[model samples]
Target: MTARNNSFDEQAVLHELKQFLPALSPGKTFTYRNPLEGFQEQTFDDALRHASEMLGYRTTLSLEEYRSLYNSKRVKPGVLEKVLVEKKGAANTFEWQDKVLMKKFPAAAESPSKIGKLRANWQKQYKTDLDARVHPRLFRILGNYLDHGVSDWKFPVRGKGFLDSMREVESNSFVSAFNTPRARNLLLQASSSINDLLTVIVGDEMLFKQYLFDQQFAHRGWSGLVATLEIGREISPNGSNITLRELIVFELLLEIDVLDDRLGRHWEPLSYRLPAPPEDLFAPVPVGEKSEVLAIWQEAVEWSYYEAILAELRQDPQNTRNQTGTRVTETTFANAVDSLCIIGQPSLLRSVTAEHRAFRHGYDFSLDPNGEMLEEILEAVVPSLGVANLECFFARTGLAGMDDILTDQMIGLLGLADTARGDLQAPLPAGLTKDFEPMRLLCVVEQFPETVLEVIDRLAVQSTCVGRRSVGRRSIALWLLNEWVHLVVIDPVSRELRVLKNRKMITYKSAPRIVIEDAVH
Candidate 1:
């Protein structure tokens, strides 16, 4: 019991291993498992019976601490007997050629939705849901990620890595199949979800080796999603292979180059718009047009604009004294260039790949090859986030040919943040709305951490979890983080980003599937 005789022995275990050495064959294995119950019931007899000689011959005791008496053995006397009875009963579930345990789509349930619902229902009906604990595929995936990082998660090509990740997901009893017509429709509508589909379409071996092998990114989950999308397009071979919908999405994507949310910057904007999308938004830009487009992270804009307002108010204190008539200077366009280039690449000249390589030594970029593509993306997304500083920044710097960036909300937030600094007589810029909602949430936490419990109580009704119908506070934090890390606005002295978004208070609950009937009233 004191880590001596009771301790399991390795030398004796090796000796006991000799007993099965002669019998191992094509199908025989020392690590025999009850193939159907998942990875839960794996075993070998001598492996257990043989004690570690390191224990010096003391009795090996195996006891249920809850029970009064003790036994000097690893397991109960009847566990193997009970297991054998079940195995004999399960003979019908397998065949010489097919095994449920080995199959990709096993008969765990009629559907994926049923997987989770059944567990919930079974727990209610039978008073116990033991399946919650054990699942073969999922555990392996989790173990692979936790210990070895994401690199080991690949499956379906070389080995069982993909199968393992899938299994782990299923074991949660939370995942549902693309079951039901509605669920299928949802997946189709989620064309923006390029990352999820990448996993399904790509060869498993490629993914495991490329993205997972390196832990360069903070959240492997997010990084994997971005990298997957970038890699998935090449796998398809065809002038006429993929569906019309996929082609359309891909075409649109090509017209406007992407600045992945992964860049970790805040896009500056003011307020939300009812969104009468611009004409060019629907009309795809010509394939070979040269344009200058800025891919600014959403929050970085907020930080940038907030600071600009600071220098303005500090220098002229009275111009914005009345919030209405103060217009931000075009200097922001130049400052925007300065701000963006600050975080850019200590120097873009250091790296110039085909993707980011500006055609003509970064001309007005208005006529450069990369410019035309980025123009469409920036124009399309900028107005919506309402970061006018970015819009103004873009056009002012000639990143785009047209479109002023100043929007009502971004200006208002900038004004408000400046006002807060002036009002609190606290020397920091102030920052609201659904767009700023996450920022506001973060601001509150930084100023007052203790109120987190109370804050979640309010967010429960207001926020939605990621991948859900409504956006939750946590998703906002993730979205905010993309910008927080980039828009490096320190206290300028203490060198700390005082504004931090606390996602801790945000809860992540799986989304509920619902059937809806759309009709014209």
Candidate 2:
């Protein structure tokens, strides 16, 4: 079916969109097909093998990680027993338990008993998995494609436009047999328009369909949003979903940033572009508002990280382990921050402290002459994420005082320019372990007054989903009034996020509940 638009081929674009649908749909909907549609007919083990063999996707647990989990009793005997019973009953009990599990967790034949060598082998084998197999250059670009909010530095590309940067990435990417002349031609042709892109990118439509079975698994969340956009659902103001066309514009802007960074050239912003100007694509970030818009997007991305980790903490409590080796049931900034890559905002850090203090002790809001008490409490509730964010913010602002806590991982990752790597004036805190510095910093935030836990409890009670469920991803719900837009789900639960299909006044207490499809473990 062709859209009303004359310039682009709608049917082809829709076909490409089908490949990009999210693998995991929110449980708000009824039973959905597994994302790995091609391998759906196969058993779990067979599917893992097929996926890896066909797509080079490392879909199964690494043998090394599996062995560690099995030895540590993290993969409990009961679970294994249940799986064995479900699969083979009592027929091949001994062989299944000993030989089968052993085969699954195969050790490198050359260094079966050598820990260091096995680790090295696993790292190399897994590093070359799936995404990398998609043509090493595409993999590197995808791996290092840092969003503006996620990293301070831009991609080191000398491209003036999206296609140009892609060309640069193609040139620098690891060359392999997969990147054939045909593939190169396809990439080049795809950039002409949405129609050409869809038709050309998926070369030999039938063959490409087999190889690129599920694009959603390629990048779950973002691709999921793209799928949602294709479905023509009503987007809440806070919904991160944007049109495919708009995404193209954003990609162009990102490439412009890369060029500007590398060549120190002032490229025109999207708004100034004539003939299909980007301003017509979406809400254009004005020249003056660019910084503020970037800041807000950065904030949203940060909160997404925070909320995501919090969800994991709530759901995967069994996995959370600290330096002292205790199970952490409650949210910890260190755990949350460590699980994610993006840095937090200084302002959010301060707000969390103030909110906690007010919630812990019944404090009158209007009576405080200044936010002095809030500041003191802020010092107490600043998590390791907050500290990292502060350090990053300080580095960008040319301020100092966090050099001692900077881990080797961070120093190597950030690769801060000398001018940005400001000096630390304060003495190193005694007893800070190199690996567990985040944990030590977390100790300070842990001491702050409690309230977020209670908030979690309230959300759990209010959640529409039945039985025990750990929260999953939460998103902002954008509601539009006559002409203005407002955020409805300021602190939304997973269920509320799902139910925000359209925009309207949301009464948190009286919202209609959708039937629970599956409990988020």
Candidate 3:
């Protein structure tokens, strides 16, 4: 132990080994600490890469998870664009967006250390599981030895170091953990250092560190506890002395004993089966396409949420009312039907048409009782007209001046008496009425006169008929389109239809249908 074998400093190696162990100790109180504290000096990306390569940790979300967020609009287009511009600049925004959104990358393969691989051949080739035979007994012994207050009975020679206690127990006990005479002899000796145990098992000075890491990390929970206790971060209530070096020595001896019993004493050191020296665990991790794609997607997903927060922060406090007070209302079914009745107003008609297309493609409309009733009336009319295209049925025809016959028919449809006409009717707004036309009303009546008559005859018997009920202008317009039962009134003086909000009476006339047909044609 005085002279360094193969220039290996046991104290320095033990200190370095502590970096890879789990920092949190098992106890009543739970604490959080980074497991890769050894590589803390490196950048976070580099540290994660080292952990993934050397320790097999999944550091980020999978590509499929990010893609799901994109589909759900959680990863918004504007937010993703901002993220791309910040990372790759404006020129490369589209390229990065395509990679994050559409392009697929293969999963990165892990490059783990080759420390225990040679020993693993025994299990693969001979079908004998060394860990299965060794770990349970080893874990139980270590757990009992390290017990703070849980165990009923204490281990013998508890105050002595881990190796010394194990040696005393094996020497005195009839039922020994070591089945082989060689392992028993090695444990009994006072001068059995970690290097001496490694020499017996691995037979290669360069691989000693790797072999210890591989062995300890296999059961990191137990090894990490021993390492934590050795560092004095955790203390046992029963005063047990343990060193990571002593624990490694005992574990190597146990492995040797298991190998001898299972494969016999003639088996060679693990080094004899090695094809080549193992890779350095602390080497620079290679960046592949998968890592790059994952990095972009991760940033984009994060910024999708972050951009909204940043935008909110940047908004002026004085202008909060402008940002927050405005209510966005969706177009209702009533508004849509009313808009169709406008003639000569091409811009208004085009906008309403676009809304209809959007609604068909899953855009939601604000619905109420009135809108729903209007929709029901349209549903009844649309089929009788033999037109599946609502747009075609509601299409604008040219404006014509209101006449005496058309005026009387419009009054009859409103269920209005001649005297009451003046009560309900108001002069249409100056410029709008001058240009307004009831094109949707004209399209239904003129194009399908016989069909409109037939539908009115059928609806006259139904309870849903607008008999004596005061209905809005939009409802009157929809019924006019369905059965020509009501002519949506243009201002009698102005000769233009009032399209929205004005309430008028509804009366169904069963006789004198020909007069309505003659007026329409």
Candidate 4:
């Protein structure tokens, strides 16, 4: 091969190649390093795109994987909403929500690297498999050259760089890994510089750096090992000296030799077959709808966990400390008890008591106390009885002559009647019945003829008692007055009165009634 004027910066290409290689030093203790340490100065999204487009690496989980997390509730709705709001602004929350939850998008295809396309043509255009033929031998050779301590015998030329050592061994050995003599001759006679070999193989000086990147990254595991060992001597205890430049040069020589053996010595460089130079590997990756969708889901998944942590941190310090097992004081215990009473227990008890009362009242009034014969009589008389007839019946029954009383005051009398009746059966404690005046009045009212009157004059409208027969404590009477049917119930044991008008119960404290007169009107 003849030397040509350099059209590219060889040192710059080598320096950039070092940046893309694995930076982790191999030793007894494992250490971590960013694979894209080269793009450290770039934004996270930029670095991710570069790694993906140039190296064919996946930087984040798949969209479906994130969607599965959402289904499992590992990604919370509130957290996702907040994340969307932060990313897209509150105005677009609904827009983004629909996109993430309902919209469907196809997965983005992996972008092919620039140099990958160049090498792939050999298999597409011709039946030759360059990677299949070259990678195995190239990896084996690179692996032996950069062996840390795994080899039984160390490489012969320890400190002399990779190409020098490989050439020395190939020249001396009777058996060789190469298929052709041209391969051996190239290794022995070729300049150690990567640019010299690229001039022969690539021909296009502009594509030299990209070609090197493509070739090295095809076997990046071995390439990275060589690159790692080259930069960091302390990575291996034996201190192997190697450079990425030497690895690239030798790998190119192997490719050329393989092409000669497979196709012919006359085969041209990859540049001759190309329509145009390959795209820049480090160019900005284009953003599409798929990436946007993935980005939204990715942020949502991450924020799901972070939101929970932030919520806890934002809580009241005292409450947070208590939750973490702080001692409870008497005041705190009392406060908790008060809160339980106010929020949890009293309202529940009130609801249950009201329901029980309604049920009991409904059951007590479900049946007619007087029997089916009187039901037929009242049902027949109810339609014919007018307000004049009802007023006359009230007058004859003596209910119209009673003094006026407010509904609340009438209810108070019923309560007193209940107490007085209970006292008659079981003697009250001495002070509990200090005054029996209300009790005396209740007994007087119970003895009135109107309390048990059954028949009315002229109209023949007999008031019939109705109540639950199973519970014999209360007695009810049905009165037909014009269009209304009134049920007046008196507890037999307590003599307490309650009215159900038009089949609905009314609050005794609020509803006003003129006793028999209201029914007449």
lDDT of each: 0.23, 0.30, 0.48, 0.46
Candidate 4: tens digits of C-alpha lDDT, residues 1-521: 22235578988878788777643234311212234446544544455555556666544445666676567555566666766765679999889777776677754555443436666656765677877788767755655555654444456666666777787788788867688887678788855467667766777776777777777666554556566656544434444566777777778778877888988776776677776655776667787555666667655553343232223222332344436443222110110000010001121122221111111111121143433333344333332232222222222212111111212222221233333332211112223422211100000011112322332122233343222111111111222211122333333333343333232332111112111211100
lDDT of 1 by residue, 1-521 (tens): 01112233323422222221111111111111111111111111111111111101111111121011102211122222222223334453234112211223222222311112311322343343323322222234222332212233432222223223333444454443222233233333444533333222111222211111111111222222222222232121111111212322232222111111211122111011112211221122231100100011122223333333333222222333445545344121122221222111112222222222121112122233233332232222222232222222222222111111222222232233323322211111222111121111011111122232233334333443222122344322222233322211222222223332232323111112222232111
Report each candidate's C-alpha RMSD, comma-separated, in the order given.
33.1, 20.9, 32.3, 39.7
Q: Provide the lowest-lDDT 10-residue window in model 3.
A: 512-521
TM-score of candidate 4 to 2 decimals: 0.56
TM per candidate: 0.18, 0.27, 0.55, 0.56
Score residue 324 of candidate 1 by CA lDDT.
50
TM-score of 1: 0.18
Better of 3 and 4 by lDDT: 3
Residue 393 lDDT (model 2): 29
Per-residue alpha-carbon lDDT of model 2 for 99-191, expressed as tens digits? 434443223244221112211221243232323233233323332342222334345553233345555555676742132353354344444
Candidate 1: which stretches are off by over 4 Å?
1-305, 311-473, 481-498, 501-521
Clashing pairs in 2: 56-130, 237-478, 238-478
Off by over 4 Å in 4: 1-6, 24-32, 108-115, 148-159, 190-192, 235-239, 315-521
Better of 1 and 4 by lDDT: 4
Clashes of 3: 1
Rank list by lDDT: 3, 4, 2, 1
Candidate 1 has its poorest 10 consecutive residues by lDDT at 288-297
lDDT of 2: 0.30
Give candidate 1's error at residue 308 in angstroms: 3.4
